[model samples]
Target chain A: MKLSREEVVHIAALARMSMSEAEIEKAREQLANILENFAVLKEVDTTNVSPTTQSIKLQSVMRNDIPGESLPAEKILANAPDREGDLFKLRPVLE
Target chain B: MTDKYTDLTIHSAHELLKAKKISSVELTKHYLDRIKKVEPQVRAIVTVTEDSALQQAKQADEAIANGKATPLTGIPVLIKDVMCTKDIKTTCSSKMLENFVPPYNATAVEKLNNAGAVMVGKANMDEFAMGSSTENSAFFTTHNPWDLSRVPGGSSGGSAAGVAASEAIYALGSDTGGSIRQPAGFCNVTGLKPTYGRVSRYGLVAFASSLDQIGPLTKDALDSALVMNVISGYDSRDSTSAPEAVPDYTKGLTKNLKGMKIGIPKEYFVEGMQAEVETAIKDAIRKLEELGAKVEWGVSLPHTRHALAVYYIIAPSEASANLARYDGSKYGFSYKDTDSMWEGMEKTKQLGFGPEVKRRIMLGTYALSSGYYDAYYLKAQKVRTLIRREFDQAFEKYDALVTPTSPTVPFKIGEKADNPLQMYLSDICTLPINIAGIPAISIPAGFAKDLPIGMQIIGKPFAEKTIFKISYAYQQVTDWHKKTAKL
Candidate 1:
């Protein structure tokens, strides 16, 4: 279950993480070992079994649509690393 | 350590306050002074909120004078840094959100606040709640109070260690896996993980959405119960918060193990576990029988062996999705060196997250990727169903189950840091309870060579009282819970 270096690179890309060659190699070996453990799950017969997404019963939580007090804009924006007036400032995605 | 206020439990401290022997400010000063002295050795706290804690202690004293005191009134406590504390730094012991201060309080914190519980500071945790040991913490490793060279099990290591070291009466910690219970085991304290949806997850930072729940790390079973009474209730803020009535957790906890059907799951006593841990847990189970519990052996949970694999899939898959919010956009750390926003997001994550966090994200992304989804993620989820069904079926026949909280005593700090799979296996005994969404308590059973051993009592869903009662019964008969680790 050795993941190719290319597979590791592809995953890092998908996760928006950049890893050096050494890091990718290490991740490849480790992830493969963890996944190897999952080989046991493949043997279980789950033909009609439904996947459990939530551990408890599901329900729709309702709330009134009426406007209520909320955190002020300044407070909501307090933790932003970079901000402009009332909006977040970000690096350019397209120039 | 010889001071009167240093090792006070919440119940005893409350009585002293009620009798006017000590004001909340005096008690707090003693604890604050204690923290100043011991924190250099234990390193369990991340941010010490001295000014605000004393302010809250002052208010607590005023409330006590008016005879409007609750059980937690004037009690000093610690909140795990994973929970949001308005205006206080809520770092998950990671650089990613090292300075992230939320504008709100976690529902559990709010409950403690209403009860006049004084929050002294934020406790440390594994970065993003990712590691089994506190070595993964970015700031510093929290030393086991019993043996400073060994790790206090994590990611709730700091909270458990704080209580064991007599730094605080108790602390609030979040458990997605074995985070709460394992650390409590390592530190010789009582830790409870309530049934899923029992406590609100509104302001706690999400790791694995389905698995995360907040609970108390305290001195003994009774203190854990008292804290549970305050924090366990419905909240409209979290959609998953249960509407179930929270019973008076401190009441009806008699040594009535008579005819209380208990199952000792055979799968839990896996091969290669520390022999000392096995002997201690078995001795605790026998003591339960002596007190009249109808203990049964060889109960099978065949799916138990696969629990760790199922958890790794479900947890990290959910984590990869939950953590997508940190993209150098709305809050926390941002990378400014890159002009390309996409590259900036990548660099931000790379620089901000620790190794374990990135490893989990990669494991999750690889599992959910197009070709592997059905084979890994979907299959794991289905097996999760099988595991839950086993627990539910077993509970139908037994009132509760008993197992070792952790497979071994606390290991040396650097023992398993580099090996991810080995670290993950440390939680094998405790993960299935989270997977099945049941309640479990880890109470100090005995010690192995001076390090503490913990016995886990697990109950059916929303049956926290039953588990707490059993743990309380055990505490009544044994002095293990009464012993404190020497700092």
Candidate 2:
């Protein structure tokens, strides 16, 4: 699975990042090398093997749904780049 | 009297504070003054909270007057910038969050505050905790307190350097892979990464949620224990936080480990390991043996050969998901206001995230995306299970495992920045512990050609107490923990 320059651009676009032509070329080469390196895993036999998510030996530890304390408006607005009376104003999401 | 206790431990600080010999205000002011003098060269702090610290110290004084002070009450502590602090600029050393302050404090920060620790400042880190050296910080690089020409190791570089320089009593650092311990090794301090879920991650801006663990970076094992006791516990806000019994870690400080067996994994002493590091580790094992502990070589962690690969796959995959929320709209470093929201996000992330971060995110998103999930992401997870099984079997025989915290001493800044694979290999010995979800500590073992090396002590899940006992006992017999960087 060699990553082409076009594929790298697609990933960047999906990830919401802009890359220059030079960066795209660099990323393509790097990604290709890494994919080649990691391809060794294809040699491993994972048949009848289950993927492990949590490393610790525990089950049934999920917490009940509960609300936590919210920071006051003063702290909330403390470092906002643009605030309009208790709201964090942004360029409107739609349009 | 002042000269005698300049390199004071956390225990000594508390005693002096109780006796009214030194107020927290004076202690904070002293370090604050030292930081002002040395920080230009050291570059350890991203922001110094002089005003809030004085105010916190005043509150500590009032608590002391009322005889209601906790062990860490009035203690000045530095936090890694990655952890969000309410009302304080919490830049994770990236332009994206340079002007961003969190509306909420991280559970760890809030817990530390509730335990009465005063915020000294936010320590500089690799951008979004992405790199292994502080050079990646958009703000400034933190120099090693031991040697200015070298780096302090990152993304917890600033925290480690602060402790090593005597600029702060102790500090808190986050470790995903080797962030906390590597810097601690480089700066000649003690760092403990508690078992994942041992500490809450509510306000920790996620890097790789599965691998990231918030822990203590301190001057000694005692301070690490003190800080851990305050920060470790269950928090409903963090669904992943472990609901285990929080023990009094300080109570086991002097517990004897006379017959406790320590395992030294043969795999860790590979060919590429520096000769100086090998010598230092052997000397450390000998010192522990002299303290009535039995040392034995064990054949364990055979899957460690693939640990780095597994980590690279899993960590970036998770990081891609975690970092996706930082679009230009809700975060800092937005592009031109005229740009559309999506356009601004693309432009902002392009300008804001470092090369390494963007690289990881791309790799991760690719791994988890529609077509390739089984080949990369799923395969890595299966290997991760094997890695954990190896540790489980090894711990069944040995009370604890010991290894070099890093294969080599800290390299110069920008030395490996250009080579991604070289940078990734730095976490070889430390990454497996995170994969296995066990508690591990990196303490100053000895120095190699004047550069410090760390001996990593690893234990079973929730066995931090055992790890500390061995570390504390070893320190009691050796002066390595007491040796300060010759800055």
Candidate 3:
């Protein structure tokens, strides 16, 4: 339950967030406290109890494979931070 | 600007509209003028669609003239910023999505639009619906109307506060734990968190997909039921939406509770619960009994204590995944001064998200990380099943369960802000119902030292009718729901 400073950094990296040294230290303490609170769950014996991912048990809610109208390319790209002629532009991933 | 229409409920407004006593344009203008007057102190609204609302109101008036008006026609409603409304900024009170305007309306919003409801504004909420108080809103904190120094409980704080302050007749809020009900309790309004899948979540910004639900906050239970009639239905876009037929929720508002077995779960009366809250809830229970409800105390939900822990783990884990889409890519806040996409994403999230949001993301990241997933995430889900089973067993014997919606009355704005654990505990009495995915409502029970206290009535899955019936029957005899804040 005790989250070390290094562990906090790792988690933040995985979460794609950067933090100041003070925030990291604070997060370390706060996250550790929250995790400690969660430790109480270990006492509950849930053997053979299936996890309930969703409350409603619905079978595949499939729609017919018919073509439907789509948002225009301009509207689709309207909110993109960087776009070029209706296509979203991202920084080079392979470079 | 007439001050008279500001205090009228959705029901009263509908009657007036039908009788031609007031036009929708006149009613909408009255609320808009009131919003202009009270919004400065309450800070309940994040965006006020004045021009569009008036236009919608004019159309509603035209519809009324043509005899095409529905129940919600011409009524003004505040929407929680989490539910998308086409072209209106759905901020979720997070700077990450502060400028993001959704191109599509959420199914709930679309339904309201179809029913001719006027969009008053988007109500403020905790950043990404992460906090129990509006203090976590990146833009500004919403003050409680009852006591300006106190917080309207959140993340649906603005919706509840808006209704309490008469800024709107009713509002829509998404409850991912105690968001709607807790705020309603704090503001002395009625809010319902429908059973999961009862309402479509198609364009609602997800916090924890499994736990989140869209519901109504109104002046009273009857208004909540009417709004539910418009918003609750199946949608093909939402895979989790139940295929069950939608019912007329307003039909369940009959003030008849004779022979209804109501359970009083003993575990909900915890150590830290405020004495005033306990007394108010006990008094409400007595009133229910007098109204012909058979009250049974000491119904045990032994797994209730683990609900908060389970919620923190599961909800944060889901939120972490859901929020990952907020990187500087398609919409929302973006950091451009970076060498690579990864750095830009990191900077965007770090700068955009608030402290509580960051804390949750980190906690969720850690919990769902490779080595820890089995120990934390899976275990929490298993415990969730146990919690749901407890509710099922209780509902098998009792028609509904009653408890205090929150452990305490509305705290001072900064009282528990420093301690996240303490703030999280504000939701202790309400979280278990969400864990079970059952419909529950917080109705004004009474006032404790001028601040309002809420009594929650919980029902089995997809049993909104039963909960609505109990709440309406209780409201029939109580004057608490009728009392308006002086502000």
Candidate 4:
């Protein structure tokens, strides 16, 4: 697959990262090389091999719903860069 | 105090505490003093819990006084900033979460605290564990303890450097691909990436959920075992956690392996490996041979060449899905000057994530997105199965596989920062195990040109005990693991 500068920008936007022109160029080249390297996977002939998701074969170990104590609010906000009354305060999201 | 305490392993420190030769508070103070003296140069810590550490040490001393203490009692430990610690700034080395603190402890932190392990502080790491070097940390990059000019290795670089410099008796590091082993190699400490399900992932911040495993970065193999025993077990909170019984990992420490077979895959000795690394690994093999283990040149992992490629696809895909949670509304770090919700999220994410992290999230989103899933993500899973099958076939005849952890020793900071491919290739020898979901460890094999070299011992699935035994045996026979950098 050919990766373009615009695609790189699109991906960056999707990933929620702002990039400079230089980073866009660098990401394009790096992703290209990685894509080319990963092209080797296309060569391996897997006619009937089942795709494995989890390495272990176990399944369905769900637990019953249970209540747990929440940590104290003071402890939660101890490291906050900015905190308000019982909540983590931040810059206004909308102008 | 200078020489002995600086390189003391968790095992030795625990022995001294048990024998009443040293007090837990004295040991904690010794490490705290060391961190105070050396952390300025290393930059390994983010938030230090000095008061809490001393209080914890006092409690440990009281426990021992009351005749009840575990093997890890009184040992000081450093956690990667990614793990949540109550009231402690668990930054994950990112500015977005720079002021973020958890209200409760991660299960691992709680377990370690209950075991009487003193929490030194949170160690610096790659922001969200996104990069190979701690250079990507939003706070600061960790310098190698051996050579201050170079990177220690990351996103677990802080933990690696901490243990290497004895800033902490032992440190816990999370490995996605080669985070644990790569830094351990560079810092010349022992690092273990336990089997995927063997260690609980409850408290560890998400990087690549399928690949991340929390393990120990320590001075020697025995301490790795001790830490592993305490950390590994079934956690009801983590669905992927293994339900298997946690064995007394230190039980096989003195077991002899006169005829055990060790495999040496020729693919690992590929062209890009540096001469010094090759020499150190060869020397380690010879030493292992002399110790009565039968060494054989084995060739089974033909798909090993595709490991790095497969890892890039698989890890990014998982990371893309895992990182979707940090959208500025529900979690830490949000930029909110924009008009729309989408714009707000974009502003927050763009401002929060670093370049390396952004690049990965993009790649992962692209791989897992529409029309490309079958070609990239699904194909990668199929290839993953083949990789596991290859290891299974190889381990049938051989007890374990041996190789160098990293191609070269610690590289200078910003050395490969521009060249991402060169940085990615560092995981060439270590990525296969994570793909196959097996346990592998990096121990100090020897040194080349003043820097340390790491020897990787790859074991079968759920057979971490075997790797521990081999590494412990190697440490007994060689003094390489005992060498300390005069920082």
- Please give the lDDT score at residue B220 for candidate 3: 84
Estimated TM-score for each candidate: 0.99, 0.96, 0.98, 0.95
> Mind giving the per-residue lDDT tens digits that candidate 3 earns over B1-487?
2357656888999999999999999898989999999999999999999999999999999999999999999999999999998888889998888888788899999999999999999999999998998999999999999999999999999999999999999999989999999999999999999999999999999999999999999988888889988898888889999878888888846667898999999999999899999999999999999988999999998999999999999999999999999888888889999778788999999999999999889888889999999999999999999999989989889999999999899999999999999999999988988888889999999998899999999998888889989999988888999888887
lDDT at A22 for candidate 2?
A: 84
Candidate 1 backbone collisions, by pair: none
> Top model by lDDT, which number?
3
| lDDT of candidate 3 over A4-79, digit per residue (tens) | 8889889998999989999988887888898889889989999999999988888667888888887667655777
Best by DockQ: 3
Kindly report which residue pairs in candidate 4 clash with one another.
Answer: A79-B99, A93-B336
DockQ of candidate 1 (2 decimals) = 0.82
Chain A TM-scores of all predicted models: 0.88, 0.81, 0.89, 0.77
By summed lDDT, which 10 consecutive residues of candidate 4 chain B come out lowest? Answer: B336-345
lDDT (tens digit, per residue) of candidate 4 on B47-107: 8889999999999999999989899888899999889887787889987787776777778
Off by over 4 Å in 3: none
lDDT of 1 by residue, B1-487 (tens): 4566656788999999999999999988888988998999999999999999999999999999999999999899999999999989999998989889899999999999999999998999999888878888999999998999999999999999999988889999999999999999989999999999999999999999999999999988889999999999999889999988888999888977787999999999988799999999999999999888999999999999989989999899999888878887888788888678888898888888989999999989888999999998999899999999999899999999999999999999999998898899999999999999899989999999999998889999998888987888888899997787765
Model 4 misplacement above 4 A? A16-26, A71-95
Model 1 lDDT, residue B71, Cα: 96
Worst 10 residues of 3 chain B by lDDT: B1-10
Candidate 4 residue B101 C-alpha distance from true site, Å: 0.4
What TM-score results for chain B in every one of the models? Answer: 0.99, 0.98, 0.99, 0.98
TM-score on 0 to 1 scale for chain A of candidate 2 = 0.81
